[model samples]
Every structure is written in C-alpha cells, then in structure tokens.
Target: MDWAEVGTLVALLAAGALLSGFLAGLLGIGGGAVTVPVLFQVLTTLDVAAETRMQIAIGTSLALIIPTSIRSLRAHLAKGAVDTVLLRQWIVTVPLGAMLGGAVANLLPSDVLEAIFAAIALVLGLRMLIGKLPFLLGRDLPGRVGRTVAGLVIGGLSAIMGIGGGVLNNTFMTLYGRTMHQAVATSAGVGVLIAVPGVVPFVVGGWGRPDLPPFSLGNVSLAALAILIPLSMPTVKLGATLAHRLTRRQLEIGFGLFLLTVSVRFIASAL
Candidate 1:
C-alpha cells in the first residue's frame, strides 16, 4: 500500500479502535455493525472492486474482530457472566453456519445480500427504538426451536454482512429471557465462531475472482485486516469488563439506541 493508503488505514483503525472499545464496553457487540460501514467506506476509497467490495468489507471486518472478540470474551469471563454451556452449543452451530454462509454469500448477487441485511437492521432497529423488543415480551420455553432458527439466519447473515452474528445472537437470547449480561457474554463467544469460519470461506470463495481488487484474498481484504485486528482487541476487552458492571436497564437503553441508529444508517446506505 502507498503512504496515503497507509495513513488512511491508520486513521480508520484509530477511530475504529476507540469506537470499538466504547461500543464493546457499552454494548458487547464487538463493533461489526459499526465496522461494516466504516470498512465499506475504506474499501471504496482504496478502489476495491465494485463487484467484491461488500464481501471484502464484511470478511475483513470479521477478520478484524478476531482479537476484539477474544479480549471481550476474557473480560466477560472474568466477570463470570459468560454462559459456557450455551456458548459451547452455539459455537458448534455458528462455524458450520459461517462456512455455509460464506459460500452462500459468494453465490448470491451483492444487491440481494445488501438488501436482506438492511432489512434485518431496519426491522431490528425499529423494534429496539420503539422499546418493544420481543425478547422483553415475557415469553418462555427451552428455546430449542428459536435457537435453531436464530442459528441459521444469524450464520447466513454473518457471512453475507461480514459480522460475527453476535448482534443477532444477542438479540435472540435477550428476547428469549436471557438477561442482558448473559446475552452480551454469550454473544462474545459467538463472535469467535463466526470470525474463524467466516474469514476462511470468504477468502476461499473470493480468491480468484477476476473482478476483485488488488490485495483481496477471496472475499477477505488483507490490507484492512492487517491494520484493524491489532487495534480492536484491547478496546473490546475494556468493553466486556465494563459490560459486567453496567446496570441492565441502562445498558438496554444505551444498546437499544445505538443499534437503532446503526440499523437506520445501514438501511439508508444499502437503499
């Protein structure tokens, strides 16, 4: 990369680090919702291929979230908020989903992928903003069916949107009667699953596409990953540690508002 490109990457990473850490600390989301758009802008500025930009953006964002998720996971674990049993079950499902989703992400037209993601963000956003999350609706069961359903959709979308699927997972759990702390902690674990498989297939599928950009590895963007991964880790750690301490009602209010905003922005951009 050129000096200008290096400088821009550095700036984005810096901003991403701060924003990521704050979001992690506040929301336990590991910054994918934020990362996608930011990476989208950076990939565009880098003259990444029009055809593969979203794929690269999503893949690179998941790649970057690797360290961040580890950091946050440790923090949540330290606070005794993590649900290992649930995480163990989900970790099994998500990676499988990630690989399948990655393949599907590559096969689908980019427009279709973007519209579906935007729709998810819009619906989730509107629900949160209205303070009417179905999770808080006081419903109860073992959630087997719900978990399976969430896994499929979250896994698919995680690959297509280039997220770790924690946002969707957390939302599902929260609505399922899991407390916010448990949901956030469990979501961190979900990130680890998606990041690994998500990056691999994206790279595999997008690798030789003639229309792709210079440094892309399949659907993943190496340049952005090089800068973003290291910078996002500590912030995620800080965020998870803080999540264990934040009040539930306050966290709910804050996370809801943030998702609401990000959701709208994503929908607007995709539209």
Candidate 2:
C-alpha cells in the first residue's frame, strides 16, 4: 500500500484501539465489540479475501483481548465489584466453551459468523434497551448445572463473536438480580477466560491458509495486535473509572444503544 494508505490504516487502528480500551473498562466488554468490526474494515482495506476476513478479524480480536482484559479486570477488581465466586466457577467451563466456539467458527462461513454476531447483539440490545422489565428468571443465579450451562454458552458465543463475554455475562447476571456493576466487573474476568483459550483454536484452524493477510499468525494478525494492544491498554483504566461514575440506568441505556447500532450495521452486511 502507498504511504497515504498506510497512514490512514494506522490512524484508524489508533482510533479504534483507544475507543475499544475505554469501552473495555466502561462496559467490561473486553473491547472486542469494537475491535472486531474495526479489524474487519482494516482487512477489507488491505484486500484480504472475503472468506478469511471475518475469521482473521475475530482471531485478532481475541488475541487483542488478552492484555486489555487483564488490565480491565484488575481495574474492576480494585473496585471490589467483580463477582470472584462466579468467575471461579466458570474457569473450566468457560474456556472449554470458548474452544468449542473457535472450532465451530472455523467451519462456518463469514456471512454465517456475521449473522450470529448480529443476532446475539440484537437480542442483548433489546434486553438492555427495555430497562428492567419484570421478566427476570430468578432473584439469584441458578444451581451448578445451570451456572455451568450459562458459562459454556457465554464462553462459546463470546468466542464466536469476538467479544470478551462481557455483554452476555452482564446480561445474564443482571437478569438473575445481580447489580449491573457486579455484572460488568465480572464480565471483565470472563473476557480473560474466553480470550486466552479462545485464540488457540482460531490459530490452529487458520494455520497454513494461503489467503491470509500480511503479518498474520494463523488468523491472528500480528500487525494489528501490535498496534491495538499498546494503544488500547492505557485507556482501559480510564473507562473503568468512568463505569464507576455512571448510574446503572445510564450504563444500561448506553450499552443498549451501542449494541443496537452494531447489530444493525452487521445485519445489513450479512443480508
């Protein structure tokens, strides 16, 4: 690419990293929600094959989550808002689910992945937008079997969608009567769980593929990772700080609107 194009790509990556880092802290989402879409656009600009673009984007997003999630988790932990017990229980099941999701993502078409991303975002968006409906399943989280199931689903779906499991975990916790702050904080921990193991399957799946972009390690783009990781890290604490300042209702509305916008964009692309 020309210097102008290179400059543009760098600029875009920089902006995306900053925004994502802030979101990671602000929403406990590990910033994959922003990273995936931004990486996809970057890959497109580089003329990456359509068949591999989404996979690469997702894989790269997961890799980016590793440090950012850790950073975000720590920030939340300091606030004593994280549900450590819940995180402990999900340790094994969530990783296992993430692995399964990465494996499944390898087999699915890009459009199908997009659809899955869009559909899940749509549901979560509506749930948040509706603002404390009386449809909660219970006043407390479910038993072991149910919690295990929830963990698996959260890990798998987050892996597939290139998220940190924040949105899903946050939604799950809030529905079960946990406070939004607790849900958000716990979701940061979940991101670490999903991202670390989640990256392996994607790398293995894309190994030796001929159509990948430059500087790629399997489906994970080292170039993107390099740019995103550092630029994103510093902003995470800032977002986490802001999260503490916002009211639960405000956070809910903001998250809901963000997800809805994302869902619409992807749904249009998928169609």
- On lDDT, the leading prediction is 2
Candidate 1, pairs of clashing residues: 24-239, 25-239, 135-175, 206-218, 207-218
Candidate 2 lDDT (Cα, whole model)? 0.90
Provide the TM-score for each candidate, comma-separated: 0.84, 0.94
Q: Model 1, stretches more than 4 Å misplaced?
A: 1-9, 131-146, 248-271
- Residue range 157-254, candidate 1, lDDT tens digits: 77767666666776777665777778788777787777877788777878678987667677777766766666666567666656766555554556
lDDT of 2 by residue, 1-271 (tens): 8999999999999998998898899889878878888888888889999999989999999999999999999999999999999999999999999999999998999988888888888897887788766778899999999999999999999999888998788879988999888988998999999999999988999999999877888999998998999999999999999999966577678868888898899888766
Instruction: State the displacement of the C-alpha of residue 120, model 2, in Å, after optimal TM-score superposition.
Output: 1.8
Candidate 2 TM-score, true structure as reference: 0.94
- As for candidate 2, its clashing pairs are none
Clash number for each model = 5, 0
